[model samples]
Target: MTLWLSSGLIFTFAAIALILYKWWDMQCIGVTPVRTLVFIAILFTSGLDVGLIMFPLTEFGGYGNVSDNPEYGFANPLAIEFGFWAFLIWGFYFLTCFYFAIIEPRVQFFEIPVVKFINNVVIIGTCAFTAYLLLANLPWYLPELSSDDGVVPAFYAIVFLSIALAVYSSSKIKYVRILSVGSSLLFIALIVGMWFRAFVLGQGSPADFFGTASMLGEYFGNLNKF
Candidate 1:
């Protein structure tokens, strides 16, 4: 994982510097899915302090058990893990977003919400909370936060959405059915497509996950050697 864990980080850190340079000169920026994905990917790579309460239990159950350097005597191995997971992964991205929010022109993404009852309030709230786990993981030095706080809410959102889906499927209400069924099918299609491409086509293992760097690095490795 040298190319992935070490070299890739160096590449992204340089890329972030390039983006910051471009942002400085361009004065106008376009938001794209790729950019956002890259940005979030960086945060997930670098930051971790905010993730103290984001999981049900320890993120790395046994990865951090062995000491990296016993002679040096580091305090917590998990904080070191967070250094990779949350800080390196998403920290710069969050700061960049903050910089954009303050410096750039913005669009209003809001509409009238007079009829809150008519919307996916529970779904939206739960999803937002899930994302907040990443943000909270940003601080990286938070004293002590319960991982259950984020996990429980995320579980609630899943349960609520599941129930809503169950009801929708059973009733098959005209409008709801269109969206629910279509989205469900679309989601399944995407999952199947990616799964086939990743594991079957690429012959990747559990480690062969996430980022263009990983995909590109594994091109020859994932092939039929035998």
Candidate 2:
């Protein structure tokens, strides 16, 4: 797992470098500042998520784990790993897409880049895998995504497929587009709420609100609620 996770982060780091290089090259050619920023936003937000702040607090402050139980003495090394990689993945995504466009000039990304064949497979696979997990992990697969209710591999599979769907679906369906936009707004609200709760209402950190979301532990559908 460590190797897998580290390798992915390394790949993203390399891609980010390549992407920035491409951006600089584009600027030399004639891309406008506004266009560059727009591309930057798309790339930056690609890996953004609800846990951006929460997980760090949880892992570093020692609030995470299946039992909220840190290893008692040692800090979680993996938490740092996750934190570092989280920063890279979004840029990594943007970099790859931009790089692909510069080189291929016409091909869509896939494997997560929106290449047509890859897109078809990902959406279908998402629905199928989700159905299978909800079925196999019956009774308790929803709580912590790392639940004991279903096939363990299913949990891993969904982690990524869900991400792929979120990225790919916006271009494919009106409903999904609305949903993606709505969720993006919701996420922004949630982040702002985090600060509000922390400063105004004195609700610990915004991550404290995540505990209230435990009710959705059993919800296995769309993430509009989160």
Candidate 3:
């Protein structure tokens, strides 16, 4: 698995470099070309998932336990978390976006009935898995909404409602644009609110914020090790 991961990382980086060299001046006109801001909003919202919200809270302690997970010893837990979510990992998205935008138009592999069916199946399966993850984690995050045996009916209802809303939003391109932009704005507001509550309203100090921010430097310093 490590060898495969390493190969993929190398290939992604090489491909990114090749794309930059060859198509640096070329415009990536997709099948449906929207404005740059809309394109960015779409990618930003699509790139995020339940894992981005839940992973750090669950895995921070595990990453910090370098005695058992010596592979993480090269950097701090915060660095490890950031590395997992950012940097080279984004290259995979870049390659996928580039392929769909540039190469797929020419090859039309996904236009085939079998390939389209398989792609839709994979996408739906991924959405279901994401919902399952949310349901599984909700019991721990909101125990009041769950019973001792397992997830409660309310939790299931919430998940179903969420899936329904997502499907409805995806029914039209205009809905998708509105949702993507709205969600992006809401996320920004959420971050600002949290920061205000923490530093301005709460007892958090600049030193505390800076000290935590400094931990991310370890990731940059040990990029090769990662």
Task: Give the alpha carbon lDDT tens digit for every residue of 104-197 in model 2.
Answer: 4444344444576776888689657655544444334355544544456656576567656666775644445355456667768988976787
Best candidate, TM-score-wise?
3
> Which segments of model 2 are wrong by more than 4 Å?
1-12, 25-85, 104-119, 130-177, 203-226
After TM-score superposition, the amount by which residue 70's alpha carbon in candidate 2 deviates from its true location, in angstroms, is 8.2
- For every model in order, what is the number of clashing pairs? 23, 7, 0
In candidate 3, position 97 carries an lDDT of 91
Task: For each candidate, give its TM-score against the true structure.
Answer: 0.29, 0.44, 0.86
The CA lDDT of each predicted structure is: 0.47, 0.51, 0.85
Report lDDT (Cα) of residue 1, candidate 2. Answer: 75
Residue pairs in clash, model 2: 109-113, 109-114, 109-115, 110-113, 110-114, 110-115, 137-150
Better of 1 and 2 by TM-score: 2
> Per the 3 Å backbone cut-off, how many clashing residue pairs does candidate 1 have?
23
Show the lowest summed lDDT stretch of 10 residues, model 1. 217-226
Per residue, candidate 1 scores C-alpha lDDT tens digits across 1-226 of 5546566557777867766676655533344323443434433422232353345134444434556444212324344444434434473664556455544435322233644443468656755675555445433423243364444354446446755664565463343435444554554687788788988888775565654334333323322210
Model 3 pairs whose backbones collide: none
Q: Which ten residues in a row have the lowest lDDT in candidate 3?
A: 47-56
